[model samples]
Target: MASLCLTCVSEGTSLEEQVRRIKDIEAIESDSFVPQAFKSSRDDTKSAVVQVKQESEKGPSQDISLPMSIVYDDSGTLAHPSLFVDKETAEELWLNRLISLRQERLMGSPVT
Candidate 1:
């Protein structure tokens, strides 16, 4: 599902490798001392630590090996969470959920 969105996104990007490419970027609106001197580094380290935790917890991403496809069914919405019609669209749908969970966990709720 998450693996199927790279073709239109980046040329020559095989579906199998789309998700493996991750770019971490952060934009801070403040040029203040706390952001540049302290909080920024703190947040970055925390993010790396969380990523490590995620890797250790999930172990292997073997599920990504499955062949992923997004068939465009002519539905009214064009994509449905329960339906696999649009794989890229479905990925967008699901990643938002993961982001929500991750953010919640970051706020100290702790999610698995």
Candidate 2:
């Protein structure tokens, strides 16, 4: 499982709009994970917490945190939003995926 705290800052878009954009990403499947958006502690920023579960043969489940942030251009034109994740978290997830792939290959199972 992976948890991500995402903060979106945009002068052109509201917090809800940013949340919608985050949900619209093609890489994040509709059924994969649902994000919960709320006001940050600072009162001036918006944040979201996303939790993801990764299935593996090792044990029950592993929890990881992948914090992300998005800062839109200040031109109020809805600049391309970006999701930033820590390099270490990204690398760990990639390695886990690779290991899962190898296990699947060895088990003669089709990789989805």
Candidate 3:
């Protein structure tokens, strides 16, 4: 999943500090998250944000600047969050992994 998709977490050398507070989001939120943590891409963040926004399915993109929910989590109570990746990677994952990982859980089938 990491290789095939644009990961949710930054590719930092270590998330020790962040991991310590993952359970309590308030604690994490209290701290000013360094915005530069996410790795830069060729299209920069505009494309990535747009893709994430589209996958979130709030509405059609007017191409106007969407000022909200760029880092939204549509997973709700699911054990894991939704993914944002390129179309090629998504198709490859669906064909290969199918009902595994997050998809398996959503389908209510225990992973073997």
Candidate 4:
């Protein structure tokens, strides 16, 4: 399959040729990451395995792919857990559970 830059190819190749190239690309399953998109880099397979181990050992995993921030409020009468949700929803969920335990203790209740 002939690969062409979508942005500049339109200016050079005929529409029919562009369509044919696109069809060729569509016929093949592309890799998760393009080979030519970036320079050759070191493959950190060991680090990747370590990260997977660490994340798995921590417990349930999440699907968030962005950064997140959370802040806690400590002045509620009902002793509610302040769940600061952002990009990291799983972290927020875990924090909420921990904070709720603290809240229970502050309220003279048993921390479950």
Which candidate's TM-score is highest? Answer: 2
Output the lDDT of residue 54, model 2.
72
Model 2: how far is 94 from its true place, Å? 0.2
TM-score of 3: 0.16
Q: On residues 46-100, what C-alpha lDDT tens digit does candidate 4 reach at each position?
A: 2221122124666777444332322334366554445444558868788899999
Query: What is candidate 2's lDDT per residue for 1-112, written digit by digit as tens?
Result: 2222255453556766776676566437657767778765553344465677776797877676554555334555554433356788879888999999999999999998
Judge candidate 3 against the unseen true structure and give its global Cα lDDT, from 0 to 1: 0.52
For model 1, give the 10-residue run with minimal summed lDDT. 45-54
lDDT of each: 0.51, 0.65, 0.52, 0.60
Clashing pairs in 1: none
Give residue 20's error in model 4 in angstroms: 79
Name model 4 segments beyond 4 Å from true: 1-87
Off by over 4 Å in 1: 1-81
Per-residue lDDT value at 73 in model 3: 49
TM-score of each: 0.25, 0.28, 0.16, 0.22
Report the C-alpha lDDT of model 3 over 1-112, residue by residue, as the tens digit: 0122123255542455455445445545666644456664533334333323233367565443444334444545655434656789889888878646778888888886
| Model 4 lDDT, full chain set | 0.60
RMSD, candidate 3, Å: 20.5
Residue 93 lDDT (model 4): 81
Comparing 1 and 2 on TM-score, the stronger one: 2
Task: Give the clashing residue pairs of candidate 3, or none.
Answer: none
lDDT, residue 109, candidate 2: 100
RMSD of each: 25.0, 21.7, 20.5, 20.1
